[model samples]
Target chain A: MYVIVSGAGSLGSALAASLVAAGHEVFVIDPDAALLARAQEDLGSVGRAGYASSVAVLTEAGAARAQIFVAVTPSDEENLAACQLAKRVLQTPRTVALANQPDNVRLFETVGVDAVVSKIDVLIANLAGSLPAHPLLKLMPVAAGSREVVGIKIPALSVAVGRAVREISLPYGSMVILVVSADGKVQTGQPDTVLQAEDEVIAVAPADAAETLWEALTELR
Target chain B: MNVIIAGAGRAGAALAARLAEGGHRVTVIDPDRRTFDALPRPRIDSGEITVIEGDGASNDVLEKAGIQEAGLFIAVAEQDVRNGLLAQKAKLIYRVKRVICSVKDEYLSAIYRGAGIETVNPAQMEIEQVMAMLGGV
Candidate 1:
């Protein structure tokens, strides 16, 4: 597969290296000559030192042949513009972006980027997971970001401590897939499977219902 | 009419003042506190125009600026993508009735305009003026 990568930042270089290692054709573009040269030398991918959003630069870089356009520029606007240009102008089949701000993931998706990964979202999820307070960890986005895979840990004071999966009114659109207890026992979530405090629940839920499901399982009642 | 103007640059501040002068409520939002100095002091002092120092693209900031009550949103940030994306977000999320963004690049401007948002390219507008000066060349 041919992949066009915009920006030669740490994330961009790592992605190019991985794609090259996977035997995919890679073309990297960036305005910074030093970064571009390093990425090109290390990854052996075609490199262009120019603005990612420039039509002339993108066209000259053979953007039309890109199977996927990965835009991880430091500037969110630049990333969005480059991905949009790749999708609209070059007809790239898929466009992925790294939103600098966690909030921009939704904007990027709504504006037609095929996928958006936010570094802040990941960091926040990791940080929130480390806290003692009940916080749902977003495992990943699925179903074009309309759905989310979440990990929730039932706390001791929660009302769901001893309730069966069917007994708890999980959010309307959420489904529990599996449960792992603190002592390392795993249980496939069935209607009869009762939840225990300190048990981690892995579930898929409509993104909008994730919070409600978290509250349902982890709320201190 | 309630208008939300993103980017407290000269254009945004001037536009906000003009709108507030016409008896319309105006809110100006920008991430930089220094840029707020450009705002019309009298309107800001009288509370006819509200000023907020926060990321104009953020939903919290926009809602705090009363985007729900806004009939129009104008994004004139230095970056075209910032202006266009914020404009789209404001329009789609808050259901703002009208949105206008300043896109410096003509190609990017066309792309945004094609997405059902109004875009004004200062460079393109300047070029048109220059062409008209040459007798419609």
Candidate 2:
């Protein structure tokens, strides 16, 4: 696959290296000539030193023939504009943008970018996972951002410790999909499945209802 | 009229001053408070012009700027992406009667226009002005 990567910064350079190592054709664009020179030397890919949103720069980078275009600039506007140019003008099949702000993810999607990766959201999720007493760990977002897969650890003193799956009243739009016992046994969640202490439950629920689901699973008797 | 301007830079400050002079309530938002220094001194002293230091792209900032009640929302931020996003939020989320943005890139201006938002392209406007000066149109 032919790929065009904008912004030749740390993230963009790293992605270009990986793509080149995978035997894919890679082209990198950046306004900094030094960064583009380094990317050319290290990744053995074509590099262009100019604004990625410029038609001349994109055409020189072979955007029209590239299968995928990725914009990883620090500026959300630049990234979005580059992706828009690549998608709308160059007719690239796929375009991805790195959203610096978490809130810009939805905006990027609404503007027709094929994918948006938000560093802020990733950092927040990592922070949530590192907390000592976080009851719910966000596994990943699914179903186009409407739902999320989460992991919950059932504490021994919780009210749900010995209750069957059917006995717990999950919040609207939430469901327990899998349960892994403390003894390393894995079972699909079913109406008759009984909860046990320290069992890790994996569930899917509406993104907004995750907290409600966690409280339901960890509430005290 | 209630107007919200999402940048306190040269263009935003000038527009806010003009609107305030016309007896319209103008609120200007920017992440840097120092940018407000560029705005002209308020003549009315009736608090017709307000300054807010916050990210215009944020919903909280927009709400605090009274975007829900704004009749006009203008995003003249330096970044095209931020302006486009804020304008979309004002039009789609806040349901403002009118939303417009200043775009440096002509292609981005076209994209914004295609998305049903109004855009002012300074670069294109400059070119048109030069053409008119040379008697080309």
Candidate 3:
């Protein structure tokens, strides 16, 4: 596969190196000559030293023929612009962007970028997972920023442990999808299904309402 | 009308001031608060013009500037790429009625214009004027 990676920043260079090692044709675009030269030497791929969002730069980087285009610039606007240019102008089959701001994940989608990965959101999720009091784990965003899939491990002292699924007053637009017992027995969430301690519940809810759902399910009295 | 102008640079600040003077509520966003010092103060006849110190390209900043209710959205950031993206977001995401951007890069201006956003490219306009004068057109 031919890939065009915009920005010779750490993320961009790493992606280019991995793609090159996989025997894929890769090209990197960066405005900084020093960074471009380093990326070219490290990844052994074509390097175009110019603004990635520029039509001339993209054309010179063979964006038209590239199967995939990924923008990993530090600026969300730059990433979005480069990806849009790749998709709209160059007609790249797939365009992905690393959204610097978590809020930009949906914005990137609205602008027609094929995919958006929010590193900050992932980092936040990881950080959230390390907190013992908050057992909610953000699985992934769904339906842009509107909804998300989340996992929560019910605590022993939690108010939800002894309650039925229907008894819990979950936030609006939140639904418990599935539950897994401590022994790893998976069960579909039903109104009559009683919650148990250590039960891992996977739920879908509006992204903004995830915390509310978490508090409802795991908050200890 | 509610107007949100991203970037408190010379062009953005000037546009914001003019719009505010016309009795349109204006909000200008920039990373540097000091940029607002260059803008004209609000007069008795002018509507409120708020200066926000934040990244113009940020969705939070745009929302804080009342982008959802904005009748006009303009991005005149120093970076053409930032302006293009912000203009697209204003039109597509926020559903602003009118979106305009100042793109210094002629190539980027063409792309933004093709995407249905109005773009003013000073460099392109200057080049065209120069060509017209030299060619006697």
Complex DockQ per candidate: 0.41, 0.42, 0.48
TM-score: model 1 vs. ground truth: 0.75
Rate residue A104 of model 1 by lDDT: 79
lDDT of 2 by residue, A60-123 (tens): 8999999999999888878888898899988999999999987678778887899899988667
Task: Give Cα distance to truth, residue B110, candidate 3, Å.
Answer: 4.2
lDDT of 1 by residue, A1-221 (tens): 98889989998999999999999999999999999999999987788999878778788888888789899988888898888888888888999999898777888888899989998865665665565766789999999999999999998767898899999998888899999999999999999999997999999999999999998998665
Candidate 1 lDDT over residue span B1-137, tens digit each = 99999988878888887899899999988888898788778888999988898988777898899999889999988888788778878876677888898988777878877767798878878888999899955
lDDT of 3 by residue, A42-137 (tens): 977788888788778889889999999999988787888788778877899999999987877887887678888999866765664566775579
Worst 10 residues of 2 chain A by lDDT: A125-134
Looking at model 2, give its docking quality level.
acceptable
What is the TM-score (0 to 1) of candidate 2? Answer: 0.72
Could you arrange the candidates by lDDT from highest to lowest? 1, 2, 3
Q: List where candidate 3 sits over 4 angstroms from the true fold.
A: A125-221, B42-47, B128-137
Model number with the top DockQ? 3
Compared with the true structure, what per-residue lDDT tens digits does model 3 show for residues B14-107?
Answer: 8987887788988888899889888876442353888889976677788888998899989988888788878887887788988999888766
Each prediction's interface RMSD? 1.4, 2.2, 1.9
